[model samples]
Target: MNPAEGAGSLSAAVQAGLEGTGLASLSAGVRRLMDAYRSGEVPAAPVLTSAREVAAYAAYRMPATAAATGAAFAQMRRGLPGWTPATVLDFGAGTGGASWAVADQLPDAAGLTLLEQSGEAIRLGQAILAESTSGALRGAAWRRWRLELSDAAERAAVQDSADLAVAAYVLGELTERQQDRLTELVTGAAPAVLLLEPGTPAGHRRILAARARLLAAGYDVVAPCPHQLGCPLEVPGDWCHFAARLQRSATHRRVKGADLPYEDEKFSYVAAARPGVGSPDCPAGRVVRRPGQRKNLVTLDLCDRDGRATKLAVGKSKGEAYRRARKTSWGDRWDDAATG
Candidate 1:
């Protein structure tokens, strides 16, 4: 289905997603409710997270998600530090883990607003905040974090005015129309908005769309190419997916209590914001290409000046069936005579 056509109700879209899919399971009643929400056959209400200790058939991924987001925010600080943003809006702030990422960074900021439409999410955010900041909350100017259950449109008028706005992995949950609307909302709220995704093709596609919109709107892009460049061919598929594996610690595994799926590459993200119009030095990813090389040799190079790349060797077209070389090496580093 076209994502753009479903922009009117973001909640309905998410409610539908909560129903069930091959990747995740949902109860039959929940499926019916979600379907009704998606079709707009019924009015939507905020649904909170069940509970912190609500026996999950799986582990509570909140801590890991929160930790990863905090790390990403730290990277954002390294990239830009001149602006000490006063107000922040965390859009699609599921359970407030990403919001904690923002709050942790701007500990002294005046206002931290967590905008979520789910009642469950709102409750979870409040509970986590209460537990995490019990004593030190008063040290921050705005000791109390604001949890509001509101739609994106309702918040758009005052959106981009924040110092920094973030929409992390949440973009994947949004439909096409909702994605566009949400982007516009964040851009409206603050001069600099950071959009992070799972680093999948679909995730990258959403970031690309935001880049196009922000560029046309005159916002400078900070990280990742906003130029909408073609794929780099790092993998065979349309998107890049790597495995991330972490050994189960006794304490950690016990906390999660499920056979955690730890792949080598679990997540990826891009940091984006309005570019300072005249400021140069935009970092770009490396691109490798070979115009003409030996039948089995591929060239290694980067398209950008700062971009760096290495190459590997693989088999050329075959008669019966095609196959790849056993090992690959950086194309430029390969000694042609020795390689041949």
Candidate 2:
């Protein structure tokens, strides 16, 4: 699919919804609140939203994030040793929406644990999992999935229980103290953890803090190079926004209704793994095509390294379209310029 073309509609809808949300007006205040809480100058609780709002947000963003997360996990899967454990955990698993992100990719994983803190959230997640028709998690003989309602206190008990742990857009909700506690739990429970966050500045800050703590604890850096560089923005703000579009099944569209949007948001994320007997060896950066070209030529440039690159020319397209003046003299000049 041509992201440039399809993205316009998705972008317009997202922009409209975001504008209606008054988030632009609240961002500065939210950032201030987050900063104050981070510095211990103020105490703040996790910002709560309506169930509908959470569902809308998840429905709009899950497809893209899940696809990207799955791809990243697939890349890392190549580097894992045969002896890597078969069980996995989804820590801070909200409604278990994200387990679908990596579920199919790690088919060999025998046990799947969804560790959530809220009984309500776990129930919602369990309901969703039970309704899936793909049988992705149910058919495999080694598969065993369960939702466990617990907090940081249970971390040590399940320490080293999982080969992989995922915290998708969960860390930003915690206070500094809680973030630290959860970080410790993740580092101890699993050898590799994919920490996903919203593409917003506040989300980035949370991940940045967690990255520091994880690195300090000796976790090996995988994708997303510059595991150490600070934010580059002269003045901080949201850096990037991405979207993922998938064809909705008839039943899905009917159940969700046309009023509910189908496009998904693609926020930025980083996948980190532990040292030895771990994920694929690679760096992370955006894939792009060559200059003055319209074809679908793809390349993955590793970040944090010098100006190094690897390229692959995948598909081709016709030359760009244009219009010229009717005048013969002007047309002649235009033709000459085109030839030149």
Indicate which candidate wins on TM-score: 2
Candidate 1 runs further than 4 Å off: 1-59, 133-156, 226-252, 255-265, 277-281, 284-340
Question: 201-304, model 2: which lDDT tens digit per residue?
Answer: 66666776777777888875554433345433213543422233454422223324444435453444555667764434443232321122233432222222
The TM-score of predicted model 1 comes to 0.58
Per-residue lDDT tens digits for candidate 1, residues 35-122, read 4334532123332245322111112334445545655555455445565566777776665556655666675777666666555555
* CA lDDT, every model vs. true structure: 0.47, 0.48
